[model samples]
Target: MRYDWTPLWRSTIGFDRLFDVLDEVQRTADETYPPYNIERVDENRFQISVALAGFSSYEVALTVEQNVLTLEGRKGEKDEKTFLHRGISTRSFKRQFTLADHVEVKGARFENGLLLIELQREIPEAMKPRRIAITGAGPGKVSQIEAKAA
Candidate 1:
């Protein structure tokens, strides 16, 4: 089914970039050359796995720009060889994931034809909200109320 995104624009402000990114994400998601999966490992950790059967870690490139995570792969050049039929795909592909603020990429490793990307969430202490304690009635309470009511 098709969705109209105009309503989002009319109801919200300062979301132009968000709409642009969402459009890009939808366009790229329709492609089916390479398949991937995103799994939440823990409360503060995540793992992104992509099926890279014929691709190697050297051919894969991982980059983080702004809040977007991008992965690109390029197969090495091969000498021309005569073949009756070719079934496996060797073309390069690119995938991207939009990351939230304060999310960090810990590292990436490849094994058994699977590319695994690890991510961690590091929240700043100052950004976290804290509760303020309410003190008991003080000596100035009576005078404070009388002066205000006056």
Candidate 2:
């Protein structure tokens, strides 16, 4: 299935990335392997936790390229063991996450069968909001009394 974004493109400017994100989301809608959570730690900090119950840190790989974060888990060969009711999954899985602009992966850690990825958005100083001082219309536009108050 495909989505037509012609109207959105015509009405908005500089939102190409938003459309791309939407497309990626639609393509991966059926993915359910390695359930995860996205939590906002603060205004600019975030954490992504993926449940990898039976996988060790060495069995999982995390990579970030361009603006996409990919997580892959490959289970190692297990010793022959017979289980009457096998439930835990040991299958390999791959997950991808599209990151926004200026969002960087701070770090990653595996704890308690969960893989946690930290993210932080660091806006450049030039891109940050600033107060612009407004001056009089012209050099001589200020009233005499107002100028004396300077």
Candidate 3:
């Protein structure tokens, strides 16, 4: 199915990136392999965990480029054996995630058949909000000073 974002494009300003992301998401297929979870650890921290039961850490790869995080997994060759009832799947899969501005991947670890990726939003000190001190005079005093200058 396709989506029409023409109306949104006309009404919003400086949101081209947002529209682009939405378009990209719509064009991609809905993949369910290697389930994952996104959790908010704190106000600016997040964690993503993926279930990789049969795959080892060496079989999986993670890459971040131009704000896009990609995960790829390739199962190793199995021994020659007959399976009467195979339940576990060792299929390879690829996943992609788009990161927002100022968000960075801190690290990733594989433990107990799960791959955990950590992310943190680190806004520069200059971009963070800060309070400005109000000093000198009230509106009346400022108006008197302006009048004297006039």
Candidate 4:
């Protein structure tokens, strides 16, 4: 499916990235080089696991640019020995995930042929809900409406 964002694109400002992301997602919908999965560990935590069979940790590169997490895998020199029927793939692949505001990458680990990426969403202190201290006007302080009514 495709969407036309002509109206929104013309009037909005600073939303080109969002529109571009949507378009890119549609364009890359058929790209399934390296399988992956995303899971929400908690309200503020997330994990992404990518299946990279036959690829070591040194072959994969993880980077975060703005709110996008990019994972690029580059296999080193191939084995000299030939296989009768090779099945396992160790090809180069690049995958990206768009992160929400305040979300950041915590850490990552490679285990059992899976690259596990940890994410945490840390809202700033000012953005969090805070209780405001209400203060009294002062001693004997009254409104003009009270005097007018009397």
Best by lDDT: 2
lDDT of 2 at 23: 87
Residue ranges of candidate 2 with Cα displaced over 4 Å: 134-150
Clashes of each: 0, 0, 0, 0
Alpha-carbon error at 148 in model 2, in Å?
36
**lDDT by residue for model 3 over 1-150, one digit each (tens)?**
888999888889999899988888787757888889999999999999999998888899999999999999998887598989887778989999899889999999988889999999999999999999988777667434345545
Q: Locate the minimum summed-lDDT window of 10 residues in model 1.
A: 141-150
Task: Judging by TM-score, tell me the better candidate of 2 and 3.
Answer: 2
TM-score of each: 0.73, 0.84, 0.82, 0.74
Q: Where does model 3 exceed 4 Å of error? A: 14-17, 132-137, 142-150
| Residue ranges of candidate 1 with Cα displaced over 4 Å | 6-25, 79-85, 134-150
How high is the CA lDDT of each candidate model? 0.85, 0.91, 0.90, 0.91
Clashing pairs in 1: none
The C-alpha RMSD of each candidate to the native structure, in angstroms, is 4.2, 6.3, 3.5, 5.0
lDDT of 2 at 10: 88
- Choose 1 or 4, whichever is better by TM-score: 4
lDDT head-to-head 2 vs 4, winner:
2
- As a whole number from 0 to 100, the lDDT of residue 132 in candidate 1 is 88
Q: Per-residue lDDT for 1-150 in model 1, tens only?
A: 445689899989989868877787777767876778889999989998888888887898999999899999999988498879876677899878888789999999987778999999888998789998988878767544445545
lDDT of 2 by residue, 15-124 (tens): 99889888888899999998999999999999999999989988999999998999999989885998898778889999999999899999999889889999999999
Q: Cα deviation in Å at residue 55, candidate 2?
A: 0.1
Name the lDDT of candidate 4. 0.91
